[model samples]
Every structure is written in C-alpha cells, then in structure tokens.
Target: MKHLVILGAGTSGTMMVNHLIGKLPKKEWKITIVDQYKTHYYQPGFLFLPFDIYTTQQVKKDGRKFIPKEANYIQKKIELILPKENLVKLEGGEELPYDILIVATGTNIAPDEIEGMDGPGWYKDIFDFYTYQGAKALRNKLREWEGGKLVVHITEMPIKCPIAPLEFVFLADSYFKNKGMRDSVDITFVTPLSGAFTKPKATKALHYLLEEKNITEITDFNIERVDYENKKIVDYADTEVEYDLLVTVPTNMGDALLERSEMGDELNHIPTNKATLQTLDHENIFAIGDATNLPTSKAGSVAHFEAEILTENILHYIKGEPLKEEFDGHANCFIETGNGKALLIDFNYTHEPVEGTFPFPGVGPLQLLKESRANHMGKMAFKWVYWNMLLKGTHIPFVSANMSTKGKHFEKMES
Candidate 1:
C-alpha cells in the first residue's frame, strides 16, 4: 500500500485527512497523521478570551475526535523532514516513509524573538491573546485592574488572524465603557502597517471605527525592543510608547522542524506555488495553512479555502494528472466592532474587500463592509459551524473556496 503522511493535525491537516479518507481507497493507501498535542483549540476564540467572552473550556476538543478512523493518529513531535528521501523523523528517532507528504504544521507566535517582551512583565503588565495560557492570564489581569494606558501592539505582519489585534482594541473600548471606566483607560493601536488594515477599502472603514471609539493609532512603527521595567516599547526609530498594560502580537513563524530540515524559506515557511499550494521544490510534498509562504492572511478561513483546492490537487497528483492552479488567496474575516456589532470583509488575491452583502447580493443575513448586530451574531454562530461542520470536512453551503464577485460591489472608499 502507498503511504500518505500528514504532519500537524490542526485545522488544515485534519480537514485534509477527512477529505482524503472519502476519496482514497483504504485497500490501496494508508494514511498517517502526526501531531504532538491531543487538544485542538478553536484559535479564533482566543480573540475573545481577554474580554471574558469565552473561557478556556469552550475552545478545546480532543484532536482524535476529528481525525477519521481510517487514518493512523500518531501523537508525537516531528523532528525533521527529509524530502529528498521521502522520510520524516519523529522525536524518538522513528523514521516514517511516505509516498506523499502534506505539511500543515501552521505558524506560532514567538514572544522570545522580541527582547524583554516575555521578561519580568510577561503575563503581568504584558500579555498576548494568541495562546490559551496568555489569553487566560490576560483575563485575570484585566479583571482586577482599574484601567490606564492600554496599548495593543503588533510586532510584524503575516500574523494569523491579522485583524484580531484591531478587534481586541475595539472590544477593549467597549469593555472599558461597559465597566464605566472609559475615561480612565487610554487605548492605542500600534501596528507596523501604515493603516488600520492591509486592504485599502477595509482600512478606511476600520480606521473610521478606531477614531469613533477614541483609540489612537501609531502607524509604521517597527519594534526594536520592549523596556518592560520602564513599561514602554521602543521602536527602531527610538520612539517610545508607554503602557500600563500591553497586549502584544509577536513575530509569527512556521514550525521549527521545517527550518531544521532546510525545507523552508527565511521565516521557516515552506516555499509554495501561490496558485497550486504545492511546495515549489518538491513535487511529492505539498503545504497549506500558515505553514506555506502564501501572500495571504494566515487565518482559519484561508486554510479552509486552501484545503478545498489542495485536496483536489493532491488527488490529481496521485492519479498522474496535471494539477489545477485554482487557489486565489481567498480570505474573509469578521471584524468585531464592539457594542454587539461587527463587520465582514471578503476578498481574494486580485480584489480588495468591497461593499456588498455576503452569500447573496441583495438578500444577505450578513452584511459586508458595514457593521450590524446580525453580523455579530453570524460571527458568534461560526464557532458552532467550526466544531460541527468545518472540522468534519463538511461543505459549508453558499461559501465556495473561490472568491465570487457576484455579490461584491467594487467601489472606491471615501478616505
């Protein structure tokens, strides 16, 4: 039997395995999935943890529950990938040979990459909501604190859920106002980008919301180091932003195993064909999610979209057929804009987020580029969809992997 090995049973890997289970005959192929952790996190829930909207218990599930019975689930850390030999080494020195390899190891936040970011003030005066531990610690910190200078900072770009930092600041504004401490707290959004968001139209809309909520924006600031003792962050240009509490999104990088194996780019992301999701160097290996160096938002939705195309490409590869170059960097996100309201944006590689209704042009229950209570409800309802449908490899109706311009209105924003 030909062996198929998948690394990191996260969203992409889990979905891909499930998709392959139905397509690949059990008699002809054997599938194996490897991951160190057994518990899978609803990563998007991490964004709401700091505000007490979600608890640690609400976002976790057994990883084995989603992996199909036909696939062998090995709970172990990967040591290296020897692509030339078609073999993967595990932590205990066991080598697994595979006819095909899939890498969905995903990216992680590296707070240690930044000086003093995780020093004396870590989980105390400074914290991040990227991980469960950090999010829970921040929750505790926010509970007892009367407010002061609260700064939400991003160290670099290409972070998973790129819009989450902005959402955090927006939620914080509403959280402080609800606690009757709006005037006592000062919120500032410090980003390396020139605007509130990467897309021009969405940036204009989100920047307006930041202004409306009285949040300060410090743009184009590249971080040098964190002066934890002084309760300040210093940029490369020597500009300092002081804070009583700092919510930082650190430098994000792919699995260190990729770097050790010398199979990844400078940031340790697998070099991939932008259109096909195939690793540029190896025909037998493919990558998806944040693991690949795709010029797209490293969000769960993007992974879901990429899986639709990558699964088809994998099947084509197995059949000795020409692979379809169909992935278009399709990504959509719901921006939580406080006070029971949110906004959604849908776009792809060639188009910026435009104004329109989602799923349907004139009859959407969810609006795009505009804030509404319905959008917030849709965002909240997504958690249920994620657990019951997305991970199960079930197709979500009306949401195609390819971006549709049918419902989108292409128009310039009023800057």
Candidate 2:
C-alpha cells in the first residue's frame, strides 16, 4: 500500500488531513500525520487572549479530537527530513517513508533572529501575542501594570494576521480607557511598512482609523535591533523608539526541519508552484498554507481555499493526469477593530482588497473594507465553522477556490 504522510497538525495540517480521509481507500493507502504538539490553538484568538476577549480554555484543545479515523496520528518531534529519500526522521531515530508528502509544517516565531530581542526585557516589559504562552504571559503582565509608553511593534513582515498588532493597539486604547488610564498611557503603532498595511487602499482606511483612535503611527521604521537594556528598538537609520511596555510580533519563519532537509527558501518556506500548490522541487510533494512562500496572507481562510484546489490536484496526481492550476491565492480575513466592531478584506495574489459587499453582491450581510458590528460577529462565528465544518473538510457555503469578483469592485489589478 502506498503511504501519504503529512507534517504538522496546526490549522493547515489539520484541515488537509480531514480533506484526505475516505477519498483514498484505507486498504490501498495509509495516511500518517505527525506533529510535535498535542494541543491545537486557535491562533487568531491569540489577539483576544491578552485583552480577555478569549480565555485560554476557549482557544486550546487536543488536536487528536479532530483527527480522522483513517489516518495514523503520530505525536513525535521531527528531527530531520531527508527529502531526497522521501523519509522523515523522528526523534527516536525511526524513519517514516511516504509515497506522497504534504507539508503543512507552518511558521514559527524566531525571537533570536533580532539582536537583544530575546534578552532581559522579554515577557517582563516586552511580550508577544503570537503564541499561547506569550499571550498568556502578556495577559498577566497587562493585569497588574500601570501603563506608560506602550509600543506595539512588528519586527518584520509576513507575520500571521498582519492587522493584529494594530488591533492590539486599538484594543489597548479601549482597554486603558476602561481602566481610566487612557490619558496617561502613550500608545504607538510601530511597523516596517511604508504605511499601515501591505495594500495601499486598506492602509489609507486603517491610517484614518488610527488617527481617529488618537493612536500614533510610525511608518517606514525598519527595525534593525532591540536595545533591551535601554528598553528601545532602533531602526536601521538609527532612530530609536523607547517603550515602557514592548508588545512585539517577532520575525516569523517556517519550521527548522525544512531548513535541515535542504528543501526550503531563505525563510525556510518550501518553494511551491503558486497555482498548483505543488512543490517546485519534487513531483511527489505538495505544500499548503503558511508553509508555502506564496505572496498571500498566511491566514486560515486562505488555507481552506487552497485545500479545495489542492485536493482536486492530489486526486489528479494519483490518477497520473495533468493537474489543473485552479488555486488563485484566494483569501478573506476579518480584522477585529475593538469596541465590538471589525473590518473584512478579500483579495487574491493579483487583486488588492477593494470596498464592496461580500458573499452577496449589493446585498451582503457582511461588508468588505468597512467596519461594522456584523463583521465582528462574522469573525467570531468563524470559530464554530472552523471546529465543526472546516477542520472536517466541509466547504464553506458560497466560498470557492478562486477569487470571486461578483461582489468585489476593483479599480485596477496589481501583479
């Protein structure tokens, strides 16, 4: 029997595993999924964790609960990936062979990548909300502390949930106001981008929102290193921004095993065919979600959309037929913008997010690029959809693998 091996059981891996079940006969193929961790986190919920919108109990769970019966789930560390031999070396020196491989290894926070970022002030005066532990630590710090200069910074780009740091600052503004310290705590949103976001249009909207909230925005500040001793982040041009509390999103990279395997790019992301979701290096391998070096938002919705197209391609690959390039990097994300409101953005590799109605043209229950309470509810309701429907490989109603232009209005396309 041929074997299908999947790496990582995070959002992307979990969904991909569910997509493969029952499609391949259990008698003919054995599916195995490996992950280092037992518990799965709702990573997007990490944004709310520090602010008490979501408790740890709500975001954390055993990943095995959602796993399918047809696959063998292995809870072990990946020590190495010998891609040339199509084998994965586990911690105990055992090797697992695969006829087909799916890489969903996902990305990680590398605090050490920046000088002095992981030093003395980490989790004391400085913290991250990306990981469960970091968010929880930051939560504890936020509770007892009196606020001063609060700097919300991003070390680099391509981090998960690009809007989250901004969300944190907005939430912090609201949080401090509720605590009656709004006037005292100085809030600054520091980013490396020339503007608020990667897309210029959305940047304009978010820039206005930041101004409305009375939060400061520091643009084009490329962080070169952190001076933990002085509690400052210095830019490449030697501009220094000091912070009493540093809430940072560190540099993000793919799994170290990918680097060890000699099968990934500079950031350790696997080189993937953007449309096919197949690895450029090997025909027997496929990549999905944050593991791919796709020029798209590494969000959960994108992974779900990519999975639909990749599932079809996998079947074609097994049948020895030419695969269709249907995946268009479709992604839609709802950014929670405090005070029970949020904004949604929908775009693909070629299109930037434009102002329009979503899911239904001119009759959307949800609006795109506009802030509303409905968008917040849409964002919250996704958690249920994720657990009950998405991870089980069910397609979201009205959502397709390609970018839907029916409800969206684009002045022009980029890329």
Candidate 3:
C-alpha cells in the first residue's frame, strides 16, 4: 500500500486527513499522521483565556478525538524530515517512508528571539497568549493584581492571527471595565507596523476602535530588547516603553523539522506555490497553513480554505495530473472588539477588506467591517463550528474557498 504521511495533527493536517480519507482509495493508500502532543488546542480561544472568558478545559481536548480511526495516529516528537530519502525520523530513531508527504507543522511563538524577553520576567510580568501556558499564567496574574501599565505588544509581522494582539487589548478594555477597574488599568497597544493592522481599510476601523476604547497606541516601535530589570522594552531607535504587565505576541516561526531538513526559508517556513499549496522544492511534498511562506494571514480560516484547494491538488497529483492553481489566499476573520461587539472581514490576494455582506451578497445575517452584537455572537459561535465542522473537513455552507467580491464596496486605487 502507498503511504501518505502527514507531519502534524493540528487544524490543517487534521482537516486534510478528513478531506482526503474519503476521497483517496482506501485499498491503495494508507494515511498516517504524527504529532508530539495528544492535546489539541483551540488556539483562537487563547485570546479569550486571559480575561477568564474561556476556561482551560474549554480550550483543549484530545487530539485523537478529531482524527479518524481509520487513519494512523502517532504521538511522538518528530526528529527530522529526510526529504531526499522521503523518510521522517522520529525521536526514537524510527523512520517512516512515504509516497506523498504533507507538512502542516504550524508556526509557534519564539519569545527567545528577543533578548531578555524570555528571561527572569517571563510568566511573571512578561507573558504571551500565543501558548496555553502563557495564557493560563496571564489569567492568574490578572486575577489578584490591581493593574498598572498593561502593554499589549507585537514583536514583528507575519505572526499567527495578526489581529489577535489588537483583540487582546480590546478585551482587556472590557475585562477591566467589567471588573470595575477600568479607571485603574492603563492599556497601551504597541506594534512594529505603522498602523493597527496590515490592511489600510481594516486599520482605519481598528484605529477608531482603539481610540474609542481609550487605549494608547505606539506604532513603528521595532523592539530591540526587553529591559526586565527596569520593567521596560527598548527599541532599535532607543525608544523605551515602560510597563507593569507586558502581554506580547512574539516572533512566530515554522516548526524546526523544516529547518533540520533544509527545506524551509530563513523563518523555517517552506517556500510554497501560493496558489497550489505545493512545496516549491519538491513535487510530491505539500505544505499548508502557517508552515508555508504564503503572503497571507496565517490564521485558521486561511488554513480551512487552503485545505479545500489542496485536497483537489493532491488528488490530481495521485493521477499524474497537473495541479490546480486554485487557492487565492482567501482569509476570513472575526475581530473581537469587546463590549459584546465584533467585526468580520473577508479578503483574498487581489482584494482588500471592505464593507460588504458575507456568504450572501446584499443579504447577510453577518455584516463586514462593521461592529455589532451579531458579529460578536458569530465570533463566539465559531468555537463550536471549529470543533464540529472545521476540523472534521465539513465544508461550511454558502462560504466558498475563494473570496466573493459581489456585495463589497471597493474604492478605486491609483496605479
């Protein structure tokens, strides 16, 4: 039997398994998925965990629960990827050979990349919500502490869920207000980017939210090091931002397995065909989600869209057919604005997010680029959708893999 080995059992890999299992002939192909941990985290929930919105139990579940019984699941650390030999070496030195390989080993926070960020202050005053441990620890810290300067920061660009840091501050605004300490807490949002977000239109909307929430904004601050001793962060330009509690989104990098195999870019993200989800270096190897160096948001919605297109491409490859250049960097995200309100944005490679009705043009139960209680409900409902439909590879009705622009109000830009 031909073996198809998947490198990770996260959202992308799990969805791919569910998508392909029924499609690929079971008599001919055997699927195997490998992951180090048995617990699968609802990463988006990490954003809400610190504010006591989602309990620790609500964010994680058995990884094996989502994976199909028919597919082989291996719980062990991946040592290296021997792409040339088409073999994967596990921590115990066991090698697994494959006819086709899928690398969905996602990106992770690298706080150690910044000097002193991971030192004495880590988990004490400095914390990151990207990981479960950090989120839980921050929750504990926020509980008894009468807040002072609460700095929500981003280390650099291309981090997973680029909007999450902004969401954190928005929630913090609401969290403190609910705690009756809104006046006591001082919230400042710091980013390396020029604005609140990468997209201009979205940034404008988010900037308005930041101002409305009375959260201070510090832009273009490229951090050099964290001065743990002085309780401040220093940038390359010698600018300093002092803080009492620093919640940061550190530099995100792809899994180290890619680095070990020398099949990745400087950030350890595999160079991929953005439209096809195929690794540029190898025809038989494919990559998706945060593992690929795709010029798109590294969010779960992007992964869900990529998984659809990749499923088709993989089938084509099995029959010795040309892969479809179908994926268009489609991403759909719900930006939580706190106070029982949120904003939803949908965009692709050639389009920027604009005001529109999603799923059905001119007839959306959901509105784009507008904050409303309905959007917040949709955001809360997504956790249920993620666990029930998304990871199971069930296609969301009315939402296609490619973005639709029919109902959007697009402004003409000068070339």
Give the per-residue lDDT of model 3 (tens digit) for 1-415: 9999999999999999999989999999999999999999999999999999999999999999999999999999999988889999998888899999999999988999999999999999999999999999999999988979999999998999999999999999999999999999999999999999988899999999999999999999999999999999999999999999999999999998898889889999999999999999998999999999999999999999999999999999999999999998899999999999999998878778879898789989899999999999999999999999999999999899998887888664333
Number of clashing pairs, model 3? 0
The models' CA-based lDDT, in order, is 0.93, 0.90, 0.94
lDDT of 2: 0.90
Q: Candidate 3: minimum summed lDDT over ten consecutive residues — where?
A: 406-415
Report residue 302 deviation for candidate 2 (angstroms): 0.8
lDDT of 1 by residue, 75-154 (tens): 99999999989999998899999999999999988999999998999998999999889998999999999989999999
- TM-score per model over all chains: 0.98, 0.98, 0.99
Could you say which candidate leads in lDDT?
Answer: 3
Relative to the true structure, candidate 3 reaches a TM of 0.99
Taking all chains together, the TM-score of candidate 2 against the true structure is 0.98
- Stretches > 4 Å off in candidate 1: 411-415
